[model samples]
Target: MRTKQDWEWLAAGSEYLAAVAVRELLQEGKSMEAYEGLAFLIESMGKSKKLALRSQLIRLMSHIIKWKCQPERRSSSWAITIDSARTEIEEIQEEVPILNRDYIESVWDKCFVRALREAQMEMGKKKCQIAALDWAEVFEEEYWFEED
Candidate 1:
């Protein structure tokens, strides 16, 4: 199983390589022939990052929905899952700051929908009235912790 550390290292390496590839492409006169691989590499890396974040965001949102809709069922495991997802997203943003804003904005609605569906299924409810959470609330570490 690839642990969080392994994923972090892979993300860092991908970001570093993409930056180097772009720099070299610029130095080599910016010709497509000289940098075709770079485009593919960057695009692939971006997709991978997006998918990873998307999965985590969905999981996080689902847990948050569960907590809100069924507070009696909350447990340490759910809190940990929320924290883990938040950390992964933060790490991705730190590694690839350029993609942070657009990625979150583009994927938020889709993630919310998936999360809602998941929560409904898990809770055995045909319909849930939970609203889409604010992005800021989703990412806020304080929200993931149990209120004292």
Candidate 2:
């Protein structure tokens, strides 16, 4: 069977996350590790050459800003994006099979990492080795350096 629509769902997730950001207005955000991991995940998804990921990410970022500045926007924060790609985070949350943040984040994290790793490997095979090696070297070196 064909896969269910993932991007539309992710767009919804982004919308939800953005709303959360606005509601919490997290002054001190997640660790750099988390952010980097998430960025890696996003970039990996971007490599698919699919506009859905980019469009979704852009929409999500907007919501995050809205959530960050919710105090200023108040109720209008969640309605931050109205483009064709825009979907209500609340709507997405409702469709969530599991209604927990930790579970959703875990799934997102795993999917992101796996996608990135595979994408990197594919690039290496494509003579995108220079690009792939540069990325691999930095993290691997840092980890090895710390072992000394």
Candidate 3:
């Protein structure tokens, strides 16, 4: 029987090990311990998914801010990055339906603040004058790089 600390350490290092331990516990008829470990794994996976979504959101929002703030400096790569991030965020939400618009809305302010700060830093500006982003502006607005 592994201790709580053992499970935490194993999970932190490799989820595979934690999962294996849970399987072993089940085979040994330790149903209660196996259940607890499975629950922990589920919670950890959910946290990871949320973090992934937040990362994509931050990337998308920051690039959009940069595009708006520095139109003169915009390039194809920026447009591509913005597009990619949007696609990835949407894909994540689709795969994990629990992370829907409501979840995005829940973390909007914090993600925006982080994105704003990152954008300002990248653009070498101490402050950016951009306003808060609405869902439509971030996800629905068309941002394309038309080749001439």
Which model scores highest in lDDT?
Answer: 3
Relative to the true structure, how large is the alpha-carbon lDDT of every model?
A: 0.76, 0.36, 0.88
Per-residue CA lDDT of model 1 for 1-148, tens digit only, reads 3344543454456766655655676787765633554555566687777788888889999999987888878887888888988898889888778658687888799889999999999999988778778877687745444646
Candidate ranking (lDDT, best to worst): 3, 1, 2
Task: Please estimate how well model 3 matches the true structure, expressed as its whole-model Cα lDDT.
Answer: 0.88
TM-score between candidate 2 and the true structure = 0.21
**What global local distance difference test value does model 1 have?**
0.76
Estimate the TM-score of every prediction.
0.71, 0.21, 0.92
TM-score-better candidate, 1 vs 2: 1
Over the stretch 55-95, how does candidate 3's per-residue lDDT look in tens digits? 99999999999988998888899889988998898888888
Which TM-score value belongs to model 1? 0.71
Decoy 3 TM-score against native: 0.92
Location of the lowest summed lDDT over 10 successive residues in candidate 3: 1-10
Shift in Å, residue 101, candidate 2: 15
Q: Where is the poorest 10-residue window by lDDT in model 2? A: 138-147
